[model samples]
Target: MLYGNRSTMSALSRMTEGNRLAQCFLFYGDKGLGKKTLAKWFAQRLLCSGTGEKPCGVCKNCRTVQKNVHPDVIWVPHSGKLQGFSVETVRDICSQAIVAPNSGDKKLYIFADCDRMDTRAQNILLKIIEEPPAFTYFIFTAGSRQTLLPTVISRLVPFAVSACTEDETLTALRELGWPDADAQEAVAAFHGNIGCCISFLEDDNVKLLVSLTKEVVRCIIDKREYDLLKVFFSVSNDRNSALWLLHDLEMVFRDAVTFRLGQDIPSISCDPVGAGMLAGKLSTAKGQYFHKCIGKAHDAIAANVNLQLVMSALCAELMSGK
Candidate 1:
């Protein structure tokens, strides 16, 4: 069910076939790019007891791993309260890693969202990863390996999972029973991040955010700065929601730029009329300027700037560009 990353998958498939699979691998890239999925697939293949090309998909070991009941497979859980893997949890994993597998010859340990792990936790895990038992296999998934210690990164092979192509994303969405129009919209909004696309499709708040973004755009075009400020204030109390709205607004501007270019690209907004109106209002230069302002707002939010002040300034700047 994994889409894209053909070359990386091919290389991994070859490694497994040749029995040259490394003891540890670091899968890093954009979120929802299927790094964790690929790690699990590789682990299933490694543990499959079938005689044919590994996994076979029907073997008992593969089935158990698929159902997440495999005794030999260890999935390191993240602590939501800490927002990362705690040092205590990493220590427990190290203790578990030293033990022999219960059912298979090799034990596969998968750590997801590893970029959230602090240095202390990573260092503790690094010691085991450095001199892991012959029966142990480790896979770590992260948005970027740069967050990890250089010493830890040097001990493992790295695989970069890129986002899927537009066609691939559309196909996957359709396969999941999404309507053609809805799938196309999600693809445009998420830019082929399947995880984000799925989240957007399932969340009603995302629909509201898109609507709010369209309203903000309309306000900007009509020179309704006060109305725009009102809308911005409505979401100011919820930083996460406000940030998401800003992100959607950024995408709307991007779509306007695409529209001005006369390209037949998919649009983030479902309303063709509004898209046309916004596109007609923005010249290439203005579109670029607005996009830059939106990017600045995102940076300011990440820096923990005051929400009201940031939103007020952003609305003022956006209106000035009009």
Candidate 2:
């Protein structure tokens, strides 16, 4: 069940209503915003045999897409430590693009996590994406557009997927059989990010990283560079964990900027108190610099820079401001 982003869904539905949809679409947003979920629903909307309110959930096409078994709806396979599509994989997709769909209406290619798709694979795909075959569609989901090459992005229609409200998240969890209290706790931990909420509940690694993130934020606020470095070194082994850590740390920094601006908005930070401390001490210029450092750290991880080295360099970069 889709949680939120009703506005995004409505806009997409309207596009299909006009039959003016693009051949390629990119759903980009922060992780756990359900970009892939929205992408699948969009596929159902295109393929649904129902009368109105596409993806009529009960339709034959909708069920098949839900099951990922629809002949015309191909979920592209990805592999590698970063879970990227390889050059060979993109080549195979290029070959498959020439074939007609089994259903004769539309053939959809779903690339769920395109955040790590290397430039080589993207370059290999540029020509086909530029001039896709009739009835062939490509949909990509990524954490951000910065991950994709500019040429590839120019050809794909971009849509930003947003997280639902905390209330909506609670409703989604309750529907999934979680008790009200547990649902509330999950919502508190991750706000409207149901995916991360579920992870916080089920994954020890996520729990550890979330806690470590709070500590890292506190260290940053207090200008404890040694403690910050220790925290990074402690979680240096796992690339995904480091990325998650960076994301959370970045959110806290974002929260600090907002706090400094006197904006009391919904926060994405793990440690709001520590974020407040940062707001009090750091100037706006310093805050933007902090954000830049975090972004560079994210870029390094995506570029497959060595995990320990990335962490070490990030520690140095972030503390350099102090």
Candidate 3:
């Protein structure tokens, strides 16, 4: 069950019910928007053996597809290199696609992260995509259509997957047995990206990162520059975790900014007293500056800049403003 993209889902359902579903569909949107999930659901619906609403999940075909055991359903292999999806892999899948379905009336081919496929590979796939066999259906997922070739984009039906609403996200978290407070915090942390929120909930490191983020903010407000240095140093070795910490800080400061504006926004930090104190310490201008610094740090990390240097520079900037 996808939370958002009701329009996309409804359109797909109508296509399925009307027997007019496109042979190739391009599911493009921001990452973590559940495009792949929707593609899988659509695949199951197309291959379903039951007479009920599309994919009757209990049906043998639906069950096999759900478990990734359906012989007629094929996934294009990723090359596991920087370019991803080699020309050879694309050509091979294109050739295999010509074969008839072994199980169901239709054959489904799924291409995940198609945006990462090399231009050469995409070009190689262009002919097959444009004129796939009658029994074959293609589904491709990408962060955006701009990453694909114009020719490739023109040949497929586009399905835009949108972000989930805060309410929809909260409902999903609650249904997963998360307490109200925890679910609220998760929503704030991930901004209603259900996939990200679920990942955050499942990771114990996220809890520690949230606590560390709150403490770092308190240190900055209290002008404890030395303590802030120590805290930043503790996570310097792990760039990935450092990146997550930066994200957590950004969320906290964002909430503080919203709080200062007198908006009753949900906050990632559970400690209202701490958040209020931080909000009082930083005016809108300073909050905005801090946010800018966090964004720069993010770019620096992505550029492979020294983690310790970046963290030290960020801490210094936060303290200097005090």
Best by TM-score: 2
Better of 2 and 3 by TM-score: 2
Residue-level lDDT tens digits of model 3 in 212-315: 88789889888999999988998899877887788767767777788899997665443455667878988898988898898789658845789999999999
RMSD of each: 4.3, 2.1, 4.5
Clashes of 3: 0
Error of 3 at 162 (Å): 1.8
On a 0 to 1 TM-score scale, where does candidate 3 land against the true structure?
0.72
The pairs that clash in candidate 2 are none
TM-score of each: 0.75, 0.91, 0.72
Model 3 is weakest, by summed lDDT over 10 consecutive residues, at 266-275
Clashing pairs in 3: none
Candidate 2: stretches off by over 4 Å: 18-20, 320-322
lDDT of each: 0.82, 0.86, 0.81
CA shift at 197, candidate 1, in angstroms? 2.3
Best by lDDT: 2
Consecutive 10-residue window with the lowest summed lDDT within model 1: 266-275
